[model samples]
Target: MPLSPAFSSILEKEYEINFTQCLPSGRLKYTELCNLLQLTAATHADLGGISFTDMQEFNQAWVLSRMRIEIKALPQWKDIVTVKTWINTLENSRSIRALEIYLNGEKIIGGETFWAVFNTVKRRPEALALGHKHFELYPDLKATKESFSKIIINPEKEEVFEKKVILSDLDIINHVNHVKYLEWCMDVVDEKIILNQKIKSFEMNFMKELSLRDQVVIHENLSDNSIVFSITKENKNCFALQLNLV
Candidate 1:
């Protein structure tokens, strides 16, 4: 759909890499970067007139489908970085959002995300009301990197750890928040891997929704200095994440 004449072109937010957001290496943690990305998305959505609360009123909500981030460099503790995000495309009940993270006036990270609108009552995907004036207010920004593809599961992977979904992991929708899964995946990986290598890219595919009743097992497949992690519930794939190290 074409953007409205008055649509905003972009949304940007600045954040400092603080101690709490950094890893032992003093760089932004993988999970923390994901948190920043999510926060930026929500803030931009609010500016676009579709905050989570706004969707909840209609018994609807937004769910992340997949995401990929290419990191050229990670911001260190006390370094100021800016995150810029925009809607790149919206169609077939899916919205593509692009993000760019800048450090010291230079681009350091590029990210792409796909989200789908869900009907809370029916527990299924729903088409967005793009014809609505508010939906037309999308930015013209594009991603610095290309979109990611599906992450394949290799059953030969080894089980890394198991975790239970607790009340604190649940979001307002009563489901395990997607960011929590990313944190679980990161925790299962060896800290030495994160400290000794620079993460070149990270991608995640959320295959199925997880809830408080779920007990998940994390599995890992290592190859070529890259690791692929998958969360399983009752032996079924719940989500898969891939991290490429340099």
Candidate 2:
């Protein structure tokens, strides 16, 4: 299918990033960055997607699946940064998009998001080909496979999660956002824990949706610097997160 005109026009939207948003460690906080990215995506919907052009006549929303955020230096609250985003492709019911977060002339962050547009009435995925007028403006899109490794959790190490679940860990989805769960998993690994000294990659299999009031157990272990992570509730596997900590 051809690219949507709406997609191309949204690339012109203005975006700003602040330096004060950085954490005590001098890096951008995880959730803050995620929220900004969400905002950026929302703006694109307004300017590009046909779903929003019709307003009340057409009701739709995008759901995020996989996302990768990389930053050499995170901008704080006061630091000014410009962001440019583009829709890349739609294949097999998935849409891939690229976003560049820059600080001054320096490129600080380069990220990509995996999304699927859902029809409000049907509550299911929508076909990008049906977006006739939407493709005229968004012409510069090339489909490409995402570059990242998948991480797997080790079952033996997961026994550690026999503990209780607390209310603080829950989120709007009733389940925790994957990144927050990652933040928790990452905290368990210390500098001295691995001799391999490098994180190659990680992956998550969201087998079951997590909801509020549901008990959760965090299971983890260090495997030569690469830690395996898994979250369970009542012996049923809810989520599995893997980290390649080199």
Candidate 3:
């Protein structure tokens, strides 16, 4: 697949917020916001000729490794938001992408994501199968005020709940979707905090992948200003999320 003439190093896409994508307060749900960011990134890759459809020819796909998001506000239902995305760096088996969300031309959210090329059939990380040189990289362009960080899981974290991965949790790659990890942790959060939009920023680290029917445990560590959640499988850490409150 060749790069489409419509492709640009920096891609911007507009999305209309519908009712289902919103929370009870009419603001967009966090998970839905993430979906929009990933969707925009995917669209950019598609137009650039390095998308899943192109890489799957060699059994490769992009998988998220880490993500950091800072939010000033959340858009409400019926609002039209623009998502702008670009690659900060892309080489070998890894890439760094930056994305921002705008409402009525005002920036409201910024996100930075780290992705890796994974061989689906071999089930391991690998270099991208397709060429990415057609896409220009902007190493200095950063979306978030703070870059992605290593989330430290507190050893004293309390076990919250446990569940088995279901079909709904799996994505196109036949593994648990990255966003599902956030959804799981978010479900155990205080409803008041979520509805009040007190989350100033959040970060997630995907240490390992989980498949359908995999049993996992959720753990929580609470502090004055932040909440950390870690998911473990068979006593091994699989994912971690840290939510910073306003």
Candidate 4:
């Protein structure tokens, strides 16, 4: 596995899981799990921002297209586990992001993901040529056509909520981690609704950078039992997420 130009640095974390599906006596909180995932995501993404050539006018962001997570074990609340992830490669312009979860140095679960890069102003995938200048900084990553786009659902009107960027979310990279954003947005979701039904799949799109003092407005849209969660910064759509809950 050779690295890609987009795969600039390594992102790793220690995650403790204290809940799972096996227990029914007490209770389970999906918000907690969603928060953990966001933390893990933030760990990996903060690493991606490192090799940037210029940050003044131009910045790059990743939106997840598809994900495959195979769990060999589940950790309860407060249990500490470790997570490691990176840009495995680039399929055309799409980046393949992968993660591994470990407990006491033993492999527990693994995750694989796909992503696309969006140019902030244009609000779309940045052309390879347009990004070539910064690409030079990541001479190792390759540009490709295989980068698949994440699925998204738009609604006529969205249910909105506001959240603050608290101190607990700062990663080693001086910004909010990826999983933190997910957890923040998912926190308001009614668990009875998410757990009662089965989710077929999910997609996450990261559009902007979040740091201290940032206030995010989370927007959720539900249709026929399916749902999409979009987070905004000062009104610009940053993350467009979709879930299939049946």
Candidate 5:
């Protein structure tokens, strides 16, 4: 079957869920799903000529500002799945990208992300377009169902846990991997809360990067049907996350 035009300029890649990427239950882990999404995003950007290497000429690099994902089911170990991604829109400094995971031709996971180009030297966000160099490669695609705005929630004052960064948490970029932030949030959340509810959606924002020297304080609030996590290091907010469950 053919996909809709709104998902055009889409880059599709196949991946096998390896044993290492799965949990003890033989299901694909959430962190591994996040890794797949990161890889897919990079590949799509490369195909669009907006890859990290391509942006280097302009002293810029892409950074994920916010991302939201919804998982319907997780593929088991050794399952072959396809990851599809495309650019949704580009406006000034920010662009929206959507990704979906399909197993046996059935959609299982879907997500949307907001990204911005960072000026390496200035240490600030740079407009995605410089003069005529706009990233409108797939401007007509409309893959996301939600707006690209940041998620907002009020966190409780007390912290659930304080975690020290270990070497395993760092990625090639020298800072803790964005996926690790989500893992940390999950670690501090009550197991009963997780097992009792079905996670419908996830939203996270990266405010600041955390490194090996940083000690993170995690705060969590469990409402009736939602959970919010806030991470801070040295009194500065690093990440804010929300999980909606049914």
Candidate 6:
């Protein structure tokens, strides 16, 4: 696909929050908020001629490596929110992108994402085959106050639950969707915290991809202000999530 005439380095798109995307409190669910940000980033890439369809021609696709999200507020059901996204850096097989969500012209959430180009057929990381120089980069512009960080897994973490990857967990890439990992960890969290909007920020790191029928165990490490969850398969770490409570 060619770059759209309306293409811009930074893109903003509006979404109407529906009841299905909200929590019992009518505020948007964290997973749904991530979906909106992902959608906006995809839209921007599509318009810039570097979308999944464009990269698929060369057996390549972008995969999330790490993500950091800071939230001041969550939109409620029936609210109209705008998501803005832009590339902070792009080189070789890796890129950094920033995204933000605004309600009534006030920014409420910001996200920093690290992505890597992967060979879908070969199932390995590789440099992107498509040209991306046409899209301007903003190395100095950042959406979140903090950049991406490594989420340290505690060796003393206790196993909380186990799950098998199912059809619902897979995305277009045939692996577990990144957001599903967050949902899994959230399930074990206190409902009162989520219902009362007590989450201030969170981070997720994807270490290995999980496929259908793959069984995994989730572990938890609790602290005074943060809770860390690590998922493992056959004693090997696959993913980690750290939730910073307000």
List TM-score per model, in order: 0.90, 0.66, 0.99, 0.52, 0.84, 0.99
Ranking by lDDT: 3, 6, 1, 5, 2, 4
Model 6: per-residue lDDT, tens digit, 4-96?
998999998999999999999999999998889888889998999989999999998999999999999999999999999999999999999
Q: All candidates' lDDT scores?
A: 0.82, 0.57, 0.95, 0.56, 0.78, 0.93
- Residue-wise lDDT of candidate 4 within 162-246, one digit each (tens)? 8788788875445665666666656666666544434434446666667788988888887885677888888787677666565
In order of listing, the candidates' clash counts read 0, 29, 0, 26, 0, 0
For residue 109, model 4's alpha carbon misses the true position, in angstroms, by: 6.8
Q: What tens-digit string does per-residue lDDT give for candidate 1 at 26-144? A: 98888888889999888777666566777776777789989999988888999999998877787767888898999989999999888999877887898874343455435456565
Model 6, runs deviating above 4 Å: none
Model 4: lDDT to the true structure: 0.56
lDDT of 2 by residue, 1-246 (tens): 224445554463344545555555555555566667666766765655434443325455455656655555566656666766766665545676777667777766666667765554664666543453453333354222244345465656645534344567654333455556666665666634322224434444555555566667878766764566777777776666655443
Regions of model 1 farther than 4 Å from truth: 1-7, 130-141
Candidate 4 accuracy as TM-score: 0.52
Which lDDT value does model 1 have at 226?
82
**What's the true lDDT of residue 119 in model 1?**
79
Off by over 4 Å in 3: none
lDDT of 5 by residue, 1-246 (tens): 122233326689999999999766777777788899999998766666667777777777778889988877888899999998877777677878888999999988888888887776676887864332433456555444564556564745568899899999987555687899999887766665454436767898999877786888988877898888888988878898888887
**Stretches of model 5 off by over 4 angstroms after superposition:** 1-8, 129-144, 148-150, 155-157, 191-197
Sorted on TM-score, best first, the list reads 3, 6, 1, 5, 2, 4
- By TM-score, is 2 or 5 better? 5
RMSD of each: 3.2, 5.6, 0.6, 8.3, 4.8, 0.7
Question: How would you encode candidate 3's per-residue C-alpha lDDT over 1-246 as one tens digit per residue?
Answer: 788999999999999999999999999999998899889999999999998999999999999999999999999999999999999999999999999999999999999999999999999999887888878899998999999888889999999999999999999999999889999999989999999999999999999999999999999999999999999999999999999998
